[model samples]
Target: MRRATTGLDLALAGLMTVAACAEVVISGGGGTALGFGVAATLLIAFRRRIPLVTACGVTVCLIAESVFVEPPDRAVPMFVLILASFSVAAHANRRDAAFGLSFLSLAMITTGALDAGDDVASLLPGWALFVGIPGGVGVAFRKRTGDVAVMEARAAAAEVAALEAVEAERRRLARELHDVVSHAVTLISVQAEAGQAVIDSDVEGARRALAAIGAASQDAVAELHAMLALLHEPSDESTGSTSTGLADLPSLVAGVRAAGLRVELVTRGVSALPPAADHCAFRVVQEGLTNALRHERNAQVRLVIDHADADSAIRVESRGTRHQSSYGGSGRGIAGLRERVAAVGGSLEVLDHDGTYCLQAVLPR
Candidate 1:
């Protein structure tokens, strides 16, 4: 701020001296003192925002030039004052700067018209073009500044969108990991228990149980590795190795149905599920079914899978009226579904308002 004030003051003083040289007598010392003093005082008063003060100060100096200084003929001095004031305003806001530029440009044209002293029409157009061209360019710069601001806003939004997309992908991977890891761990536990239950009574059955446990553990490790791979580098989105899709829905339902869920699935929109959409859709249904079976045993479940050329949808509602216990688990399943679908540019909503638990999901293609 101090530097700016000093620079403006020095510049103003120098311009005043130049205007002094434009005179023959150098005898308007009193007028010079009044005019320069008024502008300098205004400068000091508003030095923090010199552009604002300089605008009015330039007009005051012009008036002082015509009346008190040089006796009505200080064209060069007036023009210099105008230019300096406009230049100061140029660094502020573009709109105000344009106003200042116009003021200076008009002053120049008006001065030129006066110097002609005859055929005002001929002199006016030439003067306007000569002065207005610079003003017009200044106006263009103002517009360019506005354009830059608009582009900056769009860039900011794009950055936000990209960040949101990444977060969504991570959330989706989390849901998939939960399903794969949870199911595999359950199988491993069941197999381990079976092996213990029949350690000696049926050696062959026990061996099969052990083998199943090993396979389940390997599957768990592989699933974990896949999840870690995705988490390590999100950009590695090669889904050629995708194992879970809407095609896996039947087995998922059958798993829960075996646990006495009475799970029934009705699928729609079967023709157009992209790999990403299909995977997310399957996750949503699987989580919903798992939740239903875990909490609401013997509950009749109606699973509706809808897909179309543009969208994939899943809705799982359980009629656990006798139990009222289907949605009693951690409730992370629905929340996880919401995050996963939203990540893939879809939506998930669960509404259990009328003695039934209803889960709806949409994953757009």
Candidate 2:
């Protein structure tokens, strides 16, 4: 693109040179006209790169023509002065523009005064109109161009920021979906396994296991529907909150226990928590239970939660499993829980003691 623009500039310079020479040839200009025309045209090539210098060169040529070339032809060739003034105003900085305008004005005034004889006062208006108009128009164009450039830059920045925000939201939603689906699926898999084993041996135990499976499946389907509906119109109030919190832990434990994992819930200093903190706590518990059910079947699980004014916390620990379950995971549960902890301004600590796994999370009230 830059090469194409440079080529066009060079072509314009060549055309200007050709036009200057042609003017001299067709209008019978002798040595002085030919020299000034060729010099001004050649200098015009650098107008964009060194606008003030090109403007000064063109002004010098125009003044020299007025002094030396008799019976001057103010034709297309002389328009090089206007073009130089426009370039200087449009491309050069304020200091260079001021200097170029000052120099051009002084030169034109002096030349017109010298040629006007006693009618010098009459030449001022014509000189001002010719010299000021092009410069003013160029300055206006430069301002508009600068404003447009600034607006374009701001628009580009806003677009990038918006895209980044959307990506962050998608990641959050992905983490949420993982937590929901993993917990429910893990519970269902564990219960179904238990139901299969007990169906042949104990009919009552098998019935309870199947019931837990149905409940887990219903919860999974409901949560999925809510999640999908929220995705469609995100602002829908009914689908926003799950209304699941610390109070739901008993049922959660019961569901997991039906899967054949011995579980206990111990709470200390229970108090009301903010919705965000409450939700984070619930997810932490859910993810921990899901992990235990998958990797540590037939092992004892303990959930300890402390809800207070200053420091609220939840801890889950699972002893090594005696029996391995059929269901497993890719291990994104803990990482997703970590993101949840961070969102609620909390800290997470994991403990590895021999084969046992313990997860502890502390959140601000």
Candidate 3:
């Protein structure tokens, strides 16, 4: 882009130099006038790079032509001065542009006074018409270009922010769906297996397992619908609702019990927590119970929700004599839980010792 601009500048300088020389010859001006015209016109090539210097050089040439040669026609010199004033105003900073404009206008006024023997007061308005108008137009053009550039930069930043927000929403939705579906599906699978095993021997046990499966499936569908509704109209409070949180622990515990895992839930000062921390606590417990059910169905799980300290803590410990390999899950659930906890400015830890597994999370308010 810069190279193209330079090429255009050089081309414009060459053309203007030819025009100035032609004008001087047609006006029957001498070689001195022709020389001054070409020099003033050629200085325009450096206007964008060193606008103040170019304007000063052009002003000197114009004044010298009026003083020394006193050309029959001063049209070419006046045109070159106008072009220099505009370039200086457009390309230079405010202070330098102001100085250049004042200097060029004063030089033109002095030249007019010297040529016509007119009063400096009478020449002021004419010089201003030649220099001031072009400078003002150039300043307006510069301001407009700067405003457009600022708006474009802001629009680009907004687009990037919007994209980042969308990606974050996608990640959040994936985590929520994974937790809801994984927990419910695992329950349904276990209940289905239990029902199949006892279908011939115990009719009542089989019936209960089938009932649990139906309940788990229904809950899963309701949660999915809620998430979908959020997608349709996120700003509509009636449609957008959250998934399970700490307050729903009773139902969660009951569901796990129905799935054949023994869960003992203890609460201490968990009356009020921020929504993020509350939801994170629920996911920790849910993932922990789901892991216990999948690996050690008969294990006794002790779940604790404590918010007595400055920070909230959740702990789920499963007591059983299962092999370490049994608890080695695909790691998705734990990773999701960790991400959830971390997002809420919290930490998650999982421990396995002596055939026992523990999931612990600490969240800030």
Candidate 4:
């Protein structure tokens, strides 16, 4: 049950009991006491669905009034019924309270006219005011309250969902920045250390290594600038026409081979590659090869791009010796790749079997 509804019912029960008891004591408290007490008990016990029960209680009140002597207080029980109708209408909802009220109004009007004793027409206006107006208004207020509750709940849910989305994106950005910055810094540090260690014994080698360090640092700066621009100002002007794709795969393979490993690049799908598809595909292959080099160095690598069917899908696969312990990943790379693919209605898989780690992707057009 809604909290508002429960609170309303409890409050009505308390108020009715106290008011009914006070009136009973004031009005001699003699005849039809049992009927009034019973009606009060029923209304309090069934406070939420009061009008339905009160319809029956009010009918009994009219009957008890005819059969008994002292009319201790007819007004008190009628007032309690009025209060109960309003309480139910305000808390529960309009549709239910409307139905409850219809019956209560009919019972009240019929009872009033019946007790008129040949002046039934004069009693009509009083019946309408006492029963018709309050019940109708009670139902309207209940419906308005229900609509307000629904709107509040939707607003709360939307806010929660939005916050969760922002948090997830922040975590993704943190991971991306950490991986790129750390790997570049590590390479620069390793090269500087090698140059320092060899400066005295091998002057020529130290100078050559320092030159390589300079090149790596420049490459790092360029990459940092590219990524930062993509993040901070991702407009058409700032990004330019530069892209990493299958068109650039040969150069990428050559770069990895130069880094001291044999890399085989094979392609079967050149004519069917969309630029966006190719770009996303290129990142997957680049990240895969980089992971293999950094974690499983000294292992042979095979890179293959197959444009299977040339229309429905494209697949890229890279394999190398498996790494049990990689410095950068905690197994979230493949999951992130899968999430990216799923965004574009694609699929990704990474399997380490028979001493080889194979990364595969299938992207749709």
Q: Pick the candidate with the highest TM-score.
A: 3
lDDT of 1 by residue, 265-315 (tens): 777644476676677777777776666655554578888876677776688
TM-score of each: 0.62, 0.83, 0.87, 0.74
The whole-model C-alpha lDDT of candidate 1 against the native structure comes to: 0.60
lDDT (10s digit) by residue, model 2, range 236-269: 2223644567777777787777777787888999
What does the lDDT read for residue 123 in candidate 2?
A: 62
Tens digit per residue, CA lDDT, model 4, 31-103:
3674565465446545455455554555455445534533223566666556555655664455656665665
Show where candidate 1 strays beyond 4 Å.
1-28, 31-37, 40-53, 71-85, 88-99, 105-155, 190-212, 222-243, 250-271, 292-331, 343-365
RMSD of 2: 3.5
Model 4, stretches more than 4 Å misplaced? 1-15, 49-51, 54-74, 88-98, 122-124, 182-216, 223-251, 271-279, 309-331
Q: Candidate 3 — which residues are off by over 4 angstroms?
A: 1-5, 71-73, 236-243, 295-297, 319-331, 351-356
For model 3, the local distance difference test gives 0.82
Ranking by lDDT: 3, 2, 1, 4
Q: Which is the better candidate, 3 or 4, if ranked by lDDT?
A: 3
Clashes of each: 4, 0, 0, 0
Question: Poorest 10 consecutive residues of model 3 by lDDT?
Answer: 234-243
- Position 225, candidate 4: lDDT: 79
- Residue 117, candidate 3: Cα error in Å is 5.2
